[model samples]
Target chain A: MIRLEDIWRTFVMGDQSLHALQAVTETFAAGEHVAIIGPSGSGKSTLLNILGCLDKPTRGQYFFDGRAIESLDPDELAQLRLNEIGFIFQAFHLVPRLDATANIELPMTLAGVARKERSERARAALESVGLGDRAGHRPAELSGGQKQRVAIARAISMQPRLLLADEPTGNLDTHSGEQILDLLDGLNQEGITLAVVTHDPEVARRAQRVLEMRDGEIVRRISADEVSDANPIFDRGRVGKRP
Target chain B: MKPEDTFGYAVNALIQQPRRAGLSLLGVVIGVVAVIFLTALGEGARLYVTEQFQTLGTDVIVVIPGKTETTGMMPGFTGTPNDLTLDDAEALLRRIPEAILIAPISMGNDTVSYQNKSRQVVVLGSTPAFFELRGIPIARGSGLPEGDIDRGANVAVLGKETAEELFAEENPVGKSIRIGEWRIRVIGVNGPRGTHLGQNLDLVTIVPVATGMRMFNRTSLFRIMIELRPGSDIEAVKEKIEAVILDRHNEVDVTCMTPDAVIESLSAIVGTLTLVLVGIAAISLSVAGIGIMNVMLVAVSERRAEIGLLKAIGATHRQVLLVFLMESLLISTTGALVGLGIGFATIHVVTWMYPAMPAEAPIWAVFSVLALSVVAGVFFGVLPARRAMRLDPIIALSSKG
Candidate 1:
């Protein structure tokens, strides 16, 4: 479970201070799948970054599994991220030179898991993502879809309590994107809490609930069925599935 | 993380960019090679010079006229107070029971002629003990006969080259050569003796000290060489010789020097010269360190995305810094090893090519070079590693690598 109380993230540019997120309060329950939908610069990514512990809120109290995040030192925060959170990026963020298995084993390696266990877990994670045959293939050799799958494999390899995906399907073709979405939905079904930030309403449709953000504020919280009717941004043909 | 894991990652990172890693390490390689090769040369020269000094017996002490100043100015710069003569040499033998044999040397350049052939050569004047003291062997006939050094002998010992030049194919032992006004009979020919300290030993003609003193028309002897008995304390004997010279001349005007002292001073001078050369070579290692720094800085900037990714995967600041630091340390260590290999191989080739050059790197220099290279790599690595470690993950992750 996660809770954010009145989080504020501000960025100072020379003489001007810009508020990216203001008084944003939200939470996600255990084993729940939620989507945050917004246009560019709407603070969805910023909120996701804060939730992932990649960045700190300028002002807020954040609780992850009943532990206050703001009080943690840098190393403790790193440990927290290592043990409790898994992240997937739109660009797939796979180290280009490492094969699929090695990429999956990276986080565990950083966590000081023994070599034999690391390889075993890495192979198992790769199998879960249906990339068993691509274990030795580097990112450059994999399709965008396969790279995303590898990234997903890496995320779930640590068996985190929460998974955060930033536009997981943003760079993939429609068919592969659908497959990645299916894999993520399957992982969510297996009892890991999932939060996805996306512009695509189709992705938003897969989640149990949707949070619509605009102008650095969360304007509406709706169930998955209410996105098409209640949210106005997708009304302008942005809701249509990609060709 | 485990230290081996960190090591593995660093190795993998370097292996991923083989060309870049190789380029970064070249400076250290060259530095180490220069250090090893140049120090070997310096050490070899020192050894060669020391060996040359050792060829002269360590037990022999030479008394030269005039006192040498402590400032190392020319001897007798204050004044020419006394001339060391045969009498002073005999007095040293009488007063110091440690003296086993003494050779009073006198030298001059003059013309020697036998039949129609004539050549200018260095004519040395000394007792028969000169041959024994100098370790010269008689190849034919005999050395200067054991007789009174004060008595002028008409017999002469021709050097190997000097006899060959004057006699051609015929033996010159019984033949007589005219030196100015005196006809000196050749008693012996020295063996195949080579040059020492740039002096051509094989081109000199040896005669009795009194004969030389008469021929050069000089009243004072050139220098007196006293060979002490074995196991005799050289310093004690030197003091007694000085006392005898002082008693005879009324002033300590003679400079007493044992071959050990000369060899020691020479060894020290050469040793310092070797260190200076090594110092100059070590500067290259610093340059190599800077090269490592430059390459590491570039690597840090170029791999920002990877750094960010590592951080996102939960690498701490210390871990990130250590990874980068490991990279540089690996570069320098690998470079040092390659350099040492190349240096030793090249030295081997050099010694093979010229057997006379006893080229060998001193053990301390080899160890120092290894330590220096590692230090250079790690020292230069810190700045870039810190930069990489301190990078903001958000900014770094978003930047195009």
Candidate 2:
């Protein structure tokens, strides 16, 4: 379970303050699949970073499992992320030098897991992602699709309750992106809460629920079936402009 | 995280960029080698001096005229010090029962000519006990005959080099040679006694003490060398000699020197020299530490992404610090070991080449240098490790450079 109340994140330059997230608030119940869809500079990644406990809001009240996130120290926040939340990034983010199994075992190693148990769980995680045979392959040796699978395996190796993905399929070919989406859908069906941030409508179309954001504020909440008609959300202004 | 695990990770990281690691290691290796080799040389000089003193016999004590006080001037120049005469030497032999043999020494420089070959040599004046007391063996013929110290015997003993220079192929023994205005018979030639404390013992000529006093035209003896009986208390004998001289001259003008005190002071001087050499060598080690610091700083910036990933996964700041610190420590430790190997190998080769030097590093010097290098590693590693520790995971992960 997650909750936010009047969350605001601001960046201060020498002469101006930019509000990345302004008076925003949202929540996702346990085991639900939600997607935060927004164009560049809509603060979607910022929101995902906050949800993963990787960054703190400039102003907000965030509660994860009834515990106030603002009250925890940095190390405690790191511990929570290590054990309760897993992150998958657009770049795969697997350490390039480590093999698939080592990459998968990394978080568990950070958590001080036994070597034998870490190996066993890494193998299982790889198998679940259909990459068991590729456990010994490094990121450089893997295809874009396989690298994403390894990243997914690394995320789930710690068996976190919630998965936070920031542009998870943004770097893949369409076919590989579809396969990654199917894998994520399967994991969500297994009762793992999933939150994905993507500019791609096809990625949002698979989510059980979608929230469309504009100018750092959530503009609408819709079902996955309504994602095709959500183009007007981007067409409001500067649709082709880079942030 | 486990310490060994951290160590393992650090080692793995260093292996990734061996050239950088080796470059830093070179600094420490050179520093350690310089320290070991230089200190060993100082220790070798000390050992050589001690060996030379030991050969002269530890039981010998010399009573030199003039009180050697720290007057900030040449000894005997500040005061009209009494001379050490043959009477004082005889009094020491009479008063101190521990004096088994006493040889009063008088010295001068003269040209000894055998036909046309003439060589300037230091002429030593003493009885036959001087040869026995100094451990100077005879390579040919016999030493100075047993006679009274006051009797001027015309018989002379040639030093090894002195004999070679003056006599050429002819046997100098039983042959007459003129030393200055006095004609003396060559009774013996000394064996090859190498240089001791810079003085060449084999380039000297020995004659009767009275003969040297007359030849050099000196009324007082140069110094009295007293050999003690085995198991004699040297300190007690020295005190008795001083007392006898003070009673006769009514002044403690003569300074008594035991081989132990001479060796102790000489060793202390050499020890200080060794420390100074080591101190100079330690500067290079500090420079090497700076090199390590430079390398670690570069490594921290280069591996920012890896550090961020580790922190994201659950590595604490302390763990990150440990890994970086361990990396530097490993570099210094490897350098120290290699340097020690090279230093000892060089010392071995040196000793093999010159067996008399006995160049070897003291045990404490070896262990302390090791400890110093480790300290340098940790000390220099701190700043870079702290930099790595304080790195923000968000920025580090996002940073492209």
The TM-scores, one per candidate, come to: 0.92, 0.89
Please list the C-alpha lDDT of all candidates, in the order they appear.
0.86, 0.85
Q: What share of the true interface contacts does candidate 1 keep?
A: 0.51
lDDT agreement of model 1 with the native: 0.86
Docking class of 1: acceptable
The parts of candidate 1 lying over 4 Å away from their true place are A229-243, B74-81, B109-122, B161-170, B178-183, B192-203, B217-219
Compose the digit string of candidate 2's lDDT tens values, residues B314-398: 6777888988999999999889989999999999998999886769887776897799889999999999999998897766776
Q: DockQ numbers for every candidate?
A: 0.43, 0.36
**Which candidate ranks first by TM-score, i.e. highest?**
1
RMSD of 2: 3.6
By summed lDDT, the worst window of 10 consecutive residues in model 1 chain B runs over: B69-78
Tell me how far the alpha carbon of residue A86 in candidate 2 is from the true structure, in angstroms, after superposition: 2.2
Alpha-carbon shift of residue A84 in model 1 (angstroms) = 2.1
